[model samples]
Target: MSSSSHLIIKNGTVITSSHQKKTDILIVDDKIAKIGNFTSDDDDAGIIDASGLLIFPGGVDAHTHMELPVMGIHSSDTFATGTKAALYGGTTTIIDFANQSRMESLNQTLDKWFLKAEGHVYTDYALHLSVTVVNHQTIAELEGIIKHRGVSSFKTFMAYKTMMITDDEIATLMRETSKYGGLVTVHAEDGELIESIIENNISQKNIAPQFHPINRPIVAESNAISRLVNISERENLPIYVVHLSSAEGLNCALNKSNAKIILETCPQYLLLDDSKYLHTDPLEVNKFVMSPPIRPLQNHQHLWKGIADGHIKVVATDHCPFTLEQKKLGLNDFTKVPNGIPGVEHRLEILFSEGYLKGQITLNQLVQVWSTNPARIFGLHPRKGDIVVGADADLVLFDPNIKHTISSKTHHMNVDYSAYEGLDVVGKCQGVMLRGKVAIDCDGVLKINEGYGHYIHRGACVV
Candidate 1:
């Protein structure tokens, strides 16, 4: 058989958001042409015998920041490195935040991000505007971006008072987003509580990275989550809580009426703990200095429960990365360090080995929480997630039998360390295709083509 136009993935267990069936899938020109015992009539076909593998919609990471400028430093991964890491981990699409600095125009910022990602991205991408300074001008521009620029989501932060919005700003932005039919993504954390604690910690001469976990404790997170939920509910606005890390925050999400709120947590929040910060060398703790910091081991258990029961609708890699040098900029002052971890390359394996295979969550649940729900919530559903006909053929042929330990040596993100370093993960991505092009195989990122990823135009929030 000549191997050219069509590709057949034979005898794999095809898993979708809600169902898993043993089947073969035929791909033609980048769409799932046929499924369920599919056969190709064409002779020019390349086939992959996927008998023992698990096939899933490539992951859609809703919250990531690549080459993002933060606190006098840039994120470690450029759009190219970050998205390439995402492909290795089975994620085919990422909705990165288009950060609007307090002094910059949203238009300028969006354009800057587009230029940064133009020919570098290895996977499909979309933007969610982060409203750092919410005002009339910013508010008025939200709908225009949604209608014309294909940006359908907005993010507001409640924690970094100097760089974020106030309650009044949140209300205004949420109301405006509702008008534009866009989703509001909030970085929920009580600014007052956390700031006060940090001030006290600094005053007490406790200036260490480990103190960061103690300073911005779970109460701060819980307090913010509850307040955001209450405010959005009273205004009849729908909101999404990003990087939910504590039981209290999880409760605020789970206790709320489903019509009003959505919650998402990241792998760092689910796998690592405050213990990672207790190293004898204080600098070592800096690796875990993400905002809404990692919580107690019990919170990990709580988050798993949230995922299993469907209280949390999305699992994403908050892939904001910084090199060790950048991370050490605050060697003596923990507050000066950037807040994020690199997890794009380990999202699927950690979830599968720990969540699904352990029976904490089903395989379908894994597909939904990691890939399908994120795509739907972020307005990239039909095109980015799912194995349906006419959708982009961004697929992952995942081998459940592969045993690997995640580390900086084997990982692909442009970071000096892996938070999941040395941890054994059972399942790994064996092959990845982004929009019908082989971006990653056993060899790694292929230069089959440059600029293969298409910039996705997303739909306005259905809510």
Candidate 2:
């Protein structure tokens, strides 16, 4: 009935955000028209034969930092390159952070990020503003940011002495966000504890990349997480714990002692451990210098168990990439290392290979954590994370049989190295669609639809 093209996918297992079933899907233009059975009688319909593939809603990475500036260096990937890699890796939508400092206005910051993304993105995108300073003026801007600017969630840092806001300020922000129905997502780490440790390490001349994780120990993360969780619990608001990296933090999120809070862990924490910091080569150690840095090998089991038991809600890449040259800024001082790694492109594959295929999580849990939960928590659901009728035709036909080695040599991220280098993973996105258009196929090629993505405004947090 519309002018857009139609397509049909046959003989595939359709995995929705909620469940997985063997079903056929019919697409009309950018929306899924019908799902279940498709006779495929229309000669003009584009048909994809997915005889041995798993269909799922394309991944939604809710935390990424594209073209963001931090510590005097901009993250290597821009919207253009980041989204391209995200698409090739089967993510059709990314929610990148729009950061603002106390010196800047929120409205102006949103405008600046919008200008940076407009006509340069390859897949749909949303934004969550990181509020560096919370005050009367900044709190007043929340209405405009949430309603006019279409950003329904805000992030606050609990670490980074120069950037951290007071607990009172965060409490006020959380209260205001609750009033406006927006979610408060946080990077939780005790700033005072980490700073003191860093000072001690510096005084002792223990200034190597390996010392990076020691300064910010598990307690730093757990103490901060407990504080924020308490605030969220008292305010009766849902707070998202971003890049949760330790057993203590995980326990705080699970609220085994008190209240429950939403949790997100990166693949790096799930798969890698702190031993990488002790690498013989300090430069190699610098590769994993992300905040809430990878934890002890023992914590990996706790995180996996949390995910398995449904205590951890989402898995996001907090993807902020920096090149070796940029990372070397801290060669003499471990504190100077830009704290991030390249991960947007490998999040799904690694999670699939290590989680679902490895029998650690069920298929439904995979869909929930990687796609549905992110959308649901950030308000992008029903549009970005489901394979149901009337939803955008953003989907992936994954070949569970395909095996590939992850390495910097073959990855598309605009970085010199891969944090997941040499990791072997089964299952690949053999085919993909964005809003009903064939974006990538079995050949793993993008159809050159540059700037095809549009800015999507998400609603308030549902969970």
Candidate 3:
């Protein structure tokens, strides 16, 4: 069969956000054409024997940063490497953040990022504008930015005074975006409080990464989230909270009266903890430094509970990578180190082995938070998330019994190390198909070419 011919996936337990059943899926050209009990007799068809495995629509990670320039250094992973990592791990679509610097134009920023990704991507990609200064002109660009540019979601940061928006800015941006069929995403954290706490800790001669989590406590996150929720509820606009870290933050989201609010947490928050910050060799702790730093172990139960009960709607990697050398920029000072980790490649395996295999979450819930809901929330649904007819043929054949250890040596992300190194995980993705073609084989190798990915023009957020 030709590489682009119709393919039949036989006898697989197809899983969706809320249902699962043994079935065969037929892929024609670039979309799923049918799903039923059918045997292919034509020689021009490619067949995938998916017995004893679960078939899930490839993950649509709505949150990721590729080749971002921050802290005087660029993220270690470029679009090529990052998307390749995502594909190997069963993620076929990623919605990355396009930064609008303080004095930069929204259109220019979008254009610049588009150039960077033009010929370097390997899987489908989209963008969400990161709004730094939300003034009248910035607000004025909403129609062109969302409707014309096809980027319907905007992200507002609350932890960097130079970049973070105020309550007024948040309110104004939220009001305007919602009015125009757009959604707002917030990096919730009280920058003033965190700055003061960090300053106080430094004054006490506490210069350790462990102090990183101490200064930015759970309340810092909860306070910001609660305030945003209050504003969203009052202004009648929906908000998405990114990288929710602690129990308090989860509660603030869960207790919200606004059903439109969506909470996104990362794999690091679910699998790791503050204990890594307390390592004896203080220099080693730089690897784990991230905003709203990993919370205490006690917070894990609450996060898992939230994930299972549907309070949290998505699980993304945040997928920002900085090499150890880049991290050492803050060796003399913890505050100087870059704050983010790499988890793009391990999201599926980690969630499947830890969350599902351990009984912390269900298989259907796994499909929901990791793929369907993310696609729905980010406007990539109906095409990227489900296995139904007419949807893009982005799919993964997962072997629930394949056991392995995660390590940087075998991973595709361009970063220097793996945050999940030495971790044992079951349930690996054995085969990945993209647009009617085999993209990744059972040997965990790429079968597609670089620049094979198409730029997706996503619609506005709907639920």
Which one wins on lDDT? 3
Question: Which pairs, if any, clash in model 1?
Answer: 76-321
Residue 249 lDDT in candidate 1: 83
For every model shown, what is its TM-score relative to the native structure? 0.96, 0.97, 0.97
Report model 2's TM-score to 2 decimal places: 0.97
Q: 1-463, model 2: which lDDT tens digit per residue?
A: 4466889999999987567788889998899999887597677888899989999899999989998988788999999999999998889999999888768988878889999999999989999998997767888999888887779998888888767887777778878987777888888999998999999989999998889889889999989988877787777666788888988888777674445588888898899998898887778888899898898889888887788888888888988999999988877679789889999998878888999888888888888888988988888888888888899999989998999999999998999999988999999999889999888878988885779998998887887
Give per-candidate clash totals.
1, 0, 0
User: Candidate 2 — worst ten consecutive residues by lDDT sum?
Assistant: 251-260
Lowest-sum lDDT 10-residue window in model 1: 442-451
Better of 1 and 3 by TM-score: 3
Residue range 1-463, candidate 1, lDDT tens digits: 5444688889988999988998998887778778889577777777888889899999999999998888777899988888888888888888999988878888888999999998878888898988888777887788789889989898988888667778877878778877767888889888888888888999998887778888888888888888887887788888898989988888866567733778888988888888888887756888888998888888888899999888888998898887788888878888788888889888899999988888889999999888989888877878878989888888898999888888999888899888888998798887888777677875564544546666898987653
- Candidate numbers, best TM-score first, in rank order: 2, 3, 1
lDDT (tens digit, per residue) of candidate 3 on 189-231: 9998998988898999887766888888889999998888888
Task: Pick the winner on TM-score between candidates 1 and 2.
Answer: 2
lDDT of 2 at 358: 81
lDDT of 1: 0.84
